[model samples]
Target: MKNIILATTALVATAGVAAADVSISGYARFGATYSDNADDWNTASRLRLQFDVSTETDGGIVFGARQRFQTEENLSTGGATDPNNSNGARFYMSTNGFTLAMGNILGVIEAAPNLYLPTASSGMGLEGNGFYSLAANTSSNGGRFAWTAYDSAGAGAVEGVEVLYSMNGFGAHIHSTEYSYGVGANYTFSGYTVAVAYEEWDAAAPGGQVDGDSILFASIGGTIGAFDVALAYASTEFSGVEADKWSLKGGYDFGTGLTVYGFVASEDVVDESYGIGASYDLGGGVSLEGGITQTDEALDDTIVSLGAFFSF
Candidate 1:
């Protein structure tokens, strides 16, 4: 499998040399995860290869496309499968401060500027799954938050368009789909970035009527001395139902290739959750990371993960 990946990488890089720039990069990680609720230890790993290509046209417009091939190692099978599909392909055209993208594009809210988590491991064990509550036709699953502006990579090829513009430390994004639309803007000044976004989805409910749901998000991030800090808030509304969530994250860099970070969050339906973690740069595109997280809803429920990440 490793040899196959290497050969494919070489082939991809060699095929795009004619009047274009091509880059091949990827990430991989292997880790051990422990859950107190399950009382078991599990292994998790993921590999992703990114193919990026771009060229400047005669008219000075930049044209580009990107695709990612990913494989998640399943512990049950002890193997991974790389499916050849175009679900992750995205094309773009850009010049000056404006850019246009289509096909598997990110929604404005999902692409909001400076939106990130400081955790070394995936936060909350939900990975944004239970992060918000929006009205939709899908099963409620016991009333947990379960809606997002857009689906993540390899979600089986969606069609959308995104337009973005940036100038003088300010940027705006707009994305539209058949049933959903979003818009956002951000500005950076004095080492701080502030952004806000809103998105709405028209979902199909019973009786052939459309149910509208929306989300609003705001975030701010900046640096203070050796500490980096970020705060965010989100509110969702649908069918006279309203919910809100907020989180605060901070990280401190020791200037010695080691950093520590932590965060706390509160949501309307879920108990408050918090985590602390640290990462060390091993150099040469490798890093060591680990974290521990807990939620107050469970009895002795905690998750701990230790992982090594490789990037190239």
Candidate 2:
């Protein structure tokens, strides 16, 4: 009987090893920043770590988990700690070209359109810089639930669902449903890609006000004789809002690891903002980047930042 128990334990250990795969990946960034206005100017830095683990069953179902840690710095105090930091985990499964994810995840459908560009920022300017839509308000949270479906061809379209909840911070209350749901689709062909998404916030406001917002985005990118060029556009609309918001971004890569990028965005209800940046790769997983940002409303608040990133 003891031998039988020992054999069962050995079999279980082997199975676990056979079903599991793990990887380590992260990036570190350090730089200096300057602002023309009163926002302050100083050194800037950030570190992020991500862990991914996965397993596959004999039935062709895949399961995995992803966790990340993010940290930032304070420009005025030169302190390393800030409340904007975040740490979270996500669990997901995939089978038969369908994928499902839950637990502290980004809103898939709502955030998809904004992620169309390859810029370092979250493309916040595209939607009136946090004015027309409440999407930016839910940047972090207690958790989120999501689902996705895709074609096996890899270049086909994808559809997804996202739901979010949090009990603290700006909008927190049992009666106030901080939930969102939407559908999105993306297609790629000949070095060009396009995506469209729409989302509705059940109770995005504080006083039980239900607000709905939608975003439309498209991008085209390709290589042209040792240079890479990309162009992107986004339009945003909100419920009960009279004007719409839009943004345009362009970038050119010199192939020698140097690239230039710029963006201009505006909304009729708010002032306009624009930025220009450049980046150069130093090889061996290191790169240098710098950019300048200005807004019409905050004329004195021009920001210039330079930073380096290392990935492994």
Candidate 3:
């Protein structure tokens, strides 16, 4: 019995050493938000947590998992327990410039390419209304399945996927629904990057009506000195109506933890909106940020927001 226990202890130590290559990292974001239009405002505070774990095998294969959690104040229901929440998990593998992910993951076809750009004031361009905005495309949720591929030379890449669903009548019945495949590609050279993507959705309408939609988008961005700039254009075609939109944004770093940024955007069907924002790093992974936006449609209506963020 003493010899058996000694052998088991040695095996456990060996296993622990073998698993030392695994790594874990994550971040948390919390902030407060207040809008000028209280009726349109939904929440004044929010919190989110994200975690990632990864390991590399001896044969050069890398695998990982990511999980995210989010909670926010429920202003519409006058309290916090109104079920306004979201969570998701994702798994991924990669090797030799090629990568693939599955499960409730963010769409690589549309979301991944833009992530290469640096964030402005801890947020994305257009103040969270980047390519993934519901205003940019009617559907915000991604397809059920997604795939990604990259060139061995690492100069270009592509991604595609599809989604399927069948819903019974609640107010209307959807016999069959599918968000068809999408493809995106990007090329980089000498500090400049260009990307383009397309997606299609097919839906069976109420009372046997058949209709569908398609979206196309392209963007280019680059950096110089303490300044960076980006321009993006997108088009959406649904049944009979079509809309086109574009935005331009740039920022300049003044050094010593201060930066200034500005953005302008317009859609064929909506008034032009423009805004400028600034951020000051308070040191120790904390920063102060604020911005104001104005639209031509409502000359008297302006949106303003300010907040602070600290990362551990």
lDDT of each: 0.63, 0.48, 0.48
Quote the RMSD, in angstroms, for model 3: 12.6
Instruction: Give the runs in model 2 whose Cα sits over 4 Å from its true position.
Output: 1-18, 75-86, 109-116, 119-178, 205-209, 213-243, 298-300
Steric clash pairs (candidate 2)? none
TM-score of 1: 0.79
In model 1, the Cα lDDT at residue 277 comes to 77
lDDT of 2 by residue, 1-312 (tens): 245336434544554333778998888777776757656667666666678899876655566777665565642221123424444466665555555555544443434433433544332221112211222222121001111211111111122223222222111111111444554555555655555554455544322224554344444455555444444444444444433345556577777888776666565555776777777889998877777767546243676767777788
Location of the lowest summed lDDT over 10 successive residues in candidate 3: 168-177
In terms of lDDT, which candidate is stronger, 1 or 3? 1
Clash pairs (backbone) in predicted model 3 = none
> Which digits, one per residue and each the tens of the lDDT, describe model 1 over residues 72-166?
65322111133232235788767798887777787776666545564333342212112211112112122222233222235434467788899
Residue 211 error for model 2, in Å? 3.9
What's the lDDT for candidate 2? 0.48
TM per candidate comes to 0.79, 0.68, 0.68
